[model samples]
Target: MKLHCEVEVVSRHLPTLGLRNRGKGARAVVSLCQPRPPARGEQAGPHSACLLVSTMKDKRGTRYEQLKENIEQFFTKFVDEGKATVRLKEPPVDICLSKANSGSLKGFLSAMRLAHRGCDINTSLSTLTPVKTSEFEKFKTKMVITCKKEYPLGKNFPYSLEHLQTSYCGLIRVDMRMLCLKNLVKLDLSHNHIKKLPATIGDLIQLQELDLSDNHLESFSVAFCQSTLQKSLRRLDLSKNKIKALPVQFCQLQELTDLKIDDNDLIQLPFKIGQLKNLRFLSAARNKLPVLPSEFKNLSLEYLDLFGNTFEQPKALPVIKLQVPLSLLELSARTILFNRIPYAFHIIPFHLCQDLDTAKTCVCGRFCLKSFIQGTATMNLHSVAHTVVLVDNMGGTEAPITSYFCSLVCYINSSDMFK
Candidate 1:
């Protein structure tokens, strides 16, 4: 195979380069005056890749029109996308390509080899835009796909999938039976143009994590929340979209631990969101939320990102540091309140909803620890799980030592410290 390329020398430093010996100084620039395919097994993008380089000439230093297109039209198949300029450093003019067509890398490689009729052209393959990524090479299925094919909801997808992440593909749909990847655990479809998922998505009963961020989806299908996907789905991301309201079925995702709805136009979240008893992380940043639902006080959320919202800082909301990951009260319960004011925020599950004066016992009914620090005697809780309750002002004057320590060691240590 030969490359229909043009090579011309435009520069020569005979003295510095040691022309007598030849090839002895700086790197000699080799200009690629025509598009060239990447090395064997080297992947190329759907778009044409153009590479430009300076021409290193001999003693004569001849130049040609300062012209030559170094574009590798390796991709034999392409559909109409739009006209866009692909610039290169040395190759002054840009080399455009056929519209994007999704296809098989193996086939593309075979076609590229067939295109070359003569000598090879040397250039970096970085300038090419990959339509399908190297992730394709990892496929175990025996099917061969090509770029000229439009994706249909057919049954030709890979099988026995566990993880799949396809991003920036402008994808609109996928094969339905591929959802038959029952063992699939994680699937990321970020940065695509998909608007809706097929009902067959439920076939992925074992899918635990799904990322559909940066898409055109306005809402989800009813089957998504009602199907087996609801039982095993643990994480979901719906960020950067035009979704205004979530379907009521979303509340059925009881096993969901993390939910990201950032950068959307959501005015409010589903009222039944508190039903997710296991939810730990929730990010609703950059939305139009004015006030949170009262049911929100029921769930124990460790990390909540509500910045860039319309709601004012609620006094009942505990102050949260954006940089620090929030831990349960037992881990960060460093403050003790007794006959003194507690200016710093604290996380505790002392049942603020109940009549504090009548609720003589701690939320967990565990023993409390009393200690002396700074010449002041104070009582603190040794360790207890968090109860999602927020209070604005907890004056020390109203507090009384009435709970028991979780362990005898805590009691003895506090008693020894006080003594």
Candidate 2:
């Protein structure tokens, strides 16, 4: 269930900051981590255990076979009617069947079999992709390739290994087995039926940006997660996928500057997201998140898009205190009274306050760090997700109500938040 992103145009036009994808084609043998999920049987040695795992993988691929059967059924109907047309889902997967002769049907069947790599998933991945091997090889020397727009125009461009844009090709699966484009800097494989990304993509260690938006991918593979190729990635777009949670290995990308995971089924962000200190932009709109970690304040985000989420207002604040005590934020909360701070944020107030209104109640004992207000601790407030849940789960004992402030002026004059 990948969701469309709120702000995508910014990065598309942002010039690459001089980090070129220069690499020596030192190819590494890429392999998929065998998808593991069975309990090792008792009395089996590591060797026998490996064999059993192999057998399980072979059986696990039956779903792909089922999909192929469904498609074949669609073809059966088309062939009988001699309609020279095929539709996969009642409509919309219509294939012209290319003139309906027995040879044409056989050719179409061959193409269908090649396209359906479901029997062996990786066999159809970004590598060994039989879809456009000739096209990829024809302009092997060019720096960038834009296929979707090019294919319809019937035009060809010089291929540069630096960038590849293959949008709306109606590609289901591709084999990247022969792909070793060393200088590849960015790859846009958006809006396709691709459910899996080949680990071979990691071979492009110089690749700095990757856009995998609007694909059916549930999650990235473990092999790709562990790959060193991710180290060079400064911006990654994984919008509109079925991903529910990020892999723990995601913390490896310490240099990431931009990340967009909007419109997904994410309930919560990875606990290690704070590790991406270089991040300047984050868009997680339209998710199921209940709350963001307090560690979020640590990031120096330039642009943040969090609308359409389950996020409530940020924790209420009577006065905000500067953690590093910078000269800018050290105005004693009095100097900036009625003036705006640099940043605005939101948070959920599920269990802390009896009333969720920001102006009336200090739900999180915090407030907009952006609103300019005086520093004073007179007003009352409560921790939004903390104190209440703590009291309820902590033996349901009555706990003392505590009040904290980010600004005294903001606390007393909280109505400005509505502005």
Candidate 3:
């Protein structure tokens, strides 16, 4: 199952300084660490030779001393490598590795003080287990619990309270402002309770794909249209939302190739949408769009789906005077239809009723023509096969082929014309 985790950071200290100095407020750094489980073969049975040895710790001193020794041993090389060293303040008792005998929680609490002062322990943390201590709450990052503890986190397990001084701290919420996620390349806050995103989100210069689907996003972050996003963004999924209209900023996605806005409250698309030169696939299915702009005719697009839209009927095209030699001009579709007229003769029935702006051309061959008649142009034949071959002083430099039977001609060849 895919999950969307929204982590919110609440700054406990709010200073009156301007944006410049305000960033300097002291704060606790919170980090969430998910533990790694031991490998399958690492388990020991009663017959195992390693289990035969008896291990005991004499209570000559506090467990804190043991934790300090363990941390120091783990980070010796890190200090030599110039990384932060571990420094123990209140060391913990014995750290038991046996599944039956758990380690002392208080001893683990003191071990954190040596995090970056004396050893590589911080970087070598293959797995981190928090100790049960009131002071441990000072760490701000929300702890994503991956391991199930045999016992609860003490008396304050569920509704615990701790007093710590920091610039940011707390549980996640729906509306967050200026969340600095500059390093994020792809983000999916889908199916979340998030209500709003700050306009400064465009500050993330490296973002390539963002999925805000299935949210209560009544509005959009205009910062998305910033120049930084316009150049690199490729995919944007905003389906299942309450958005009603496409903002003009949407046109700024010049590099976008796939755009999905299906299952929304949108009534119309932004007029500048056709300005996307690299658009390959566009899905506006299940929308309330009455009609698509004629500008779509100018697109070199190959695939388009307008299923489940409010377009009661197909749109009509303005009668255009064919100017270019449309013979070489290819209006491509997966299939072609020759309407009420069968594929018996060269004269093909045009589906002018479907999309008139497209000048459907015929392939001067056999197999291609057979498929054109039997396969392509199957759905809504009336809309796709009824093409009209116009005869005039337009594309063909040869004088317009005029004849009383011109309109009656079944197959309008490249050299022929039909007005």
Candidate 4:
């Protein structure tokens, strides 16, 4: 039986003295076999089987260690993930064999245990041999394809794949096979012709960076905003798309740090955009945004760019739409938000849940829905960012930001800002 993997041999007898290959391990083939018959006039050895370790480097010469004499204790140690160590006692010195690839390591340990017990291994030879490499392993972890011809012909991607890029591939839709890559961390489908993304794209729970820029995506899916991606996604690029609006659930991705949605048809960002506390870089240039969201003032960014956007001028007076007595819907929504109650499609009507999620937040850190006053105020971009770009050719650094108030008293308290 043979196992192929990296190996490192350490001697416990001489701790200070360095062996031929000390710290760095080498690729090797470890095997177990029956002891050869004694030669003419040679005394027979007591062992029924033997273990051998052979290095793979031919130029460095083969190194063999036979474990037949003075064999004491044999046991395995789980050093770490994909790694194990086997230790054998030989009177004066202790031999330690360490390697990686847990599958191979487990098989080797099983064979070694059987050999030490003087019993024949009942396992098949194919099971004992090293695993053959799969076609998917050829790409290692990162795979990039710039054109259709470069894309691999396969129904599924390797689960080991972490980063995959298919830019300029002219793909009209996301490959369904890629949704199975749960271990994926980054996926770049930029410069493609994709008109929409599959909801299953959110199944990649490990994904961190997603680039769908330069596509024909008309709108971001609400399903995607409610997926597990909200917890994992850190960087997103939707630049040069046809996306007109983003779902309010998009703000739940608090892990986001970098966002680029430049050159889109976005009329307004999500109302709860300030929920992304980690955001540092933002670029929404060339959009059709009329005014920023009420929560836009909550963000603290390192870089801000709103150039080429047609922002509306601040209004002279706030629009008063407050209800004399808060409606039942507004009161219930406020209760849900204040109590942090978890709501989903399974718990209530989908539209009701969506309305609650998209509810507006007042300047005094309270939520409002249907019974709030709407107002707009001019805000200097430099107040939120360390570096700011001119919003237009007029060298304007200020843009109109919307605000909401849950009550008449709240609106009166913030009325000075509209003057």
Candidate 4 lDDT over 334-367, as tens digits, reads 9999889999899999999878878889989889
lDDT comparing candidate 4 with the true structure: 0.76
Tens digit of lDDT per residue, candidate 2, span 1-419? 00000101011122466443332221111112222333567331111111000111132211111223334333445442222333333222332331122333444344444333334331222111112223224324333334554542343332234677777776565436214444467877777778887876676666788888888877767677668765788888988888787765575677788888877788667644655788877777676665554334345666665555554334444344434343443342323333423322244234322111121112233443333233222111122211212122223312112233344543455443433
Stretches > 4 Å off in candidate 4: 1-139, 154-158, 344-349, 415-418
Model 3: per-residue lDDT, tens digit, 89-199?
234211222101012212222234343233323322322333323423432232222222422234322111111111122212322322333334555556655566666
lDDT of 1 by residue, 354-398 (tens): 112121112233312222111112222111113212111342211
Error of 3 at 135 (Å): 23
Cα lDDT, all candidates: 0.47, 0.45, 0.39, 0.76
Candidate 3 shows a clash count of: 36
Preferred candidate (lDDT higher): 1 or 3: 1
**Which has the greatest TM-score?**
4
Error of 1 at 405 (Å): 36
**Residue 157 alpha-carbon offset, candidate 3, angstroms:** 23
* Number of the candidate with higher TM-score, 2 or 4: 4
